[model samples]
Target: MIDAHIHLDQYDQTGIKEMINKWSENGIAGVVAVSTNLKSSYDILKLKQEYPNFIRAAIGHHPEEPPPNTRDLYELIDLVHQERKQLAGIGEIGLPTYKKEELYTKYSEEQFIDVLETFLRVAKKENLPVSLHAVHEEAKKALISLKKLKVELAHFHWLKASASTVNEIVSSGYFVSVTPEVCYRERDQLLVKQIPLEQLLIETDGPWQHGGPFSERQTTPLLLKEITTCLANILHIRYNELLEIICHNTKQLW
Candidate 1:
C-alpha cells in the first residue's frame, strides 16, 4: 500500500524514521511528503535525500496563507521550478476557505484567485500534476482553472462539495483522495460514492486529521489500512482490489 499524501516532515525526526520503518514492516511501499510552505518543501527534500526510495517530496505554498503579490508569486514559481523533478508534484495548493474569518481578513477573494492562478501557471510550465485543497465554490473554480492548464492527475484531498462538482472533477480525469476521517464522516462517504474507483486514491493528511484503528492520539502511515478498509466497504469491493486501484492512481501522478 502507498499513502499518497503525508507530512513526514511534520513528525518528530526520530518518530518519522521509526514510522517509515514500521511502514516497511507493514508492507507499505512509499509516501509522498507534501509541502505546506517553502520551509516544509525544503524539509521534504531533505527527507527524500535521506530515504530516496521510500519518500517523494512535493513543493508549493498552501493557499490558506496570505496571498502573494506579483513579486512574491514569481519567487514562489522559481522555488517550485528549481525543485520540480526532485519533487513528485506541485501542491497542497489551491483556494482558501472563504468562510474562515481569519483567512478572509488576511486575503480577499481576488487576491486568492491571483495566487491560485500563479500556482497553476507554474504547474503547467513544469509539466507537473498538483494536489489541491479546494471545497465548495472554491473547488469549482480551481477545477476550471486546472482544466484550462491541461494538467492531468491532480489530486483533491478531503473535498467538500456537491455531487455535480465531484462528477465534473471525475470526468476531467483528475483523482480525489479520501482521508481516514472518511471512516466516520458521512459527507466523505457520499464523496466516495460520487467518485469512480479508477479516479480515487487514499491519503492520511497525517500528523493532522487523525482517526481510525491506530492510536487516535496521533495519525501515522500505519493507519492507512483503516482508510483502505473503509474505502473497500464504500466501493463495495475487496480490500486488495481497492488497494490495487488506488495504488495505480497514485502512480499516475509520478
Candidate 2:
C-alpha cells in the first residue's frame, strides 16, 4: 500500500535505509513524500532520484509557517518549471490553521492567501495534482481558490472541516486523506464515513506525533498497516479489497 502523504525528508538519515527496507518487506508499495519548503522540495526530489519507483514527490510551502521570501518564492516557482517532469504534485500548501494567530503578528491573512493562490496558479499551470493542508474554517477558502483556478486533482490531507464542506469536497471529486488517528479518534472515523471510498486516501503525516495508541511512537509508513486495517473495518469492506481500492485511489491521483 502507498502512504498517501508523509514528510519523509524530516526523518533522521541515521537508519531510513533500513526503515524503508523493513517497510517494503512488510508490504508497503510506495510513498508520496511531501515537502514543507524549497529546501524540503529539493530533498524530496533527490530522494525520488534514489528511489524512483518507491517515492512519489510533491513540493510546496506549508501554510502554517512564515511565507517564503519573494526571491525564494520565485526560485521555487522556477524550480517547479525546471523539474516539472520529476514532480508528482505541488503540495503541503494551503491556508494555515494551527499557526494563523501567531502568523498574523507579522503576516496578514490576505498575504497568506495571495501566496497560496500564487502556488495554486502554478499547480494549475503545471497540470499537477495538489496536496493541501487546509483544515477547519480555512478549508472553505482553500476550496474556493482551487475551484476558481480549476485545479482538477487535489488531496486534502488530514482534513477537518464541516460536514457540508466535506460533502462538497467529495462532490467536487477531490480526495481526502485519513491518518493513523482513525484507529482511535472519533473525528477521523466520522470523517472517513463522510468521504466516499473512491475519494479516500490514507497517510501517516509522519514525524508529527499522534496521541492515543500512537503516542510516543515515531511515525512512519509502517503505521499505514494499522490505518488500513482500521479503515477496512470502518468501511466494512474486506481487508484486501479495501487495500486494493485505496491503493488505486492513491495511484489515480499521484
Candidate 3:
C-alpha cells in the first residue's frame, strides 16, 4: 500500500531509518513525504535520496502559520524548480481555514493567496501534482485558482467540503484523500460512500494523532492496515481489492 501523504521530516532520523528498513515487511510500497517549509522541503528531498525506492518528495510551505517573508516563499518556489526532477510534486500547500481568522489577521488574505498562487503557478509550469490543504470555503477558493491555472493533477488532502464542492472536485478529475478518521467518523465515511474508488486515496496524516484507539498511540503508516480494512468494510469490498485500487490511485497521482 502507498501512504499518499506524511511528514517524514517531522520524525526523528533514527525512527525514520527504522521505518524505512521495515517498508517491505510492513507491506508499505511507497510514501509521499510532504513538507511544510523550506527547511522541511530540503529534509524531504534528502530522505527521498536516502530511500529512493520508498519515498516520493513533495516540497511546499504550509498555510496555517504566518508565512515566511514573501522573498523566502519565492525562494522555496525556486527550490521546487531547481529540484524538479528529484521531486514527486508540490504540496501541503493551500489557503487556511481552521486557523483562518488568526492567519488572515496576521498575513492578510491577499498575502496568503499570493503565496498559494506562486506554488500553483510553479506546479502548472512543472507539470507536477499538488497535495492541498484547503477546507470549507477555502476549498472553493482553491478550486477556482486551480481551474484558473488549469492544473490537472491536484490532491486535496484531508478535505472537508460541501456536496456541491465535492462534485466540482470530482468532475474536475482531481483527487481527494481520506485519513484513519474514516474508520470512526461519520462525516469521513460519508465521503467514502460519495467518492468513486478511482478518485479516492488513503493516507495516515501521520505524526498527527487522532482520537479513539489512536489517541495515545504514536502515528505510523503501519496503522494503514487497519484503516484499509475499515474502508473496505465500509465500501463492502474485499480488503485486497481495496488495497490494490488505493495503490493504483496513489501511482496515478505521483
> Model 2 TM-score?
0.98
Residue runs of model 2 more than 4 Å from their true location after superposition: none
True-structure RMSD for candidate 2: 0.9
Off by over 4 Å in 3: none
Assess the local accuracy of residue 173 in candidate 2 as a C-alpha lDDT between 0 and 100: 98
List runs of model 1 lying over 4 Å from the truth: 69-72, 211-215
Of the candidates shown, which would achieve the greatest lDDT relative to the real structure? 2
Q: Write the per-residue lDDT of candidate 1 for residues 70-185, one digit (tens) a residue.
A: 66557667877776668788878888875447888766787777777777787777777788989888899998888776766588877888899998999998888888888888
Model with the higher TM-score, candidate 1 or 3: 3
Please, what are the lDDT tens digits per residue for candidate 2 over residues 1-254?
Answer: 99999999998877778888988999999999999998998999998998898999998999988999999899889988999999999988998899988999999999888988999899999888999999999989999998998987989999999999999899999999999999999998998999988999999999889889999798988899889889888889899999999999999999
Return the TM-score for each candidate structure.
0.92, 0.98, 0.97
Candidate 3 lDDT tens digits, 130-156: 999998899999999999889999999
**Error in Å for residue 36 of model 2:** 0.6
Please estimate how well model 1 matches the true structure, expressed as its whole-model Cα lDDT: 0.80
Q: Which whole-number lDDT from 0 to 100 does residue 33 have in model 1? A: 78
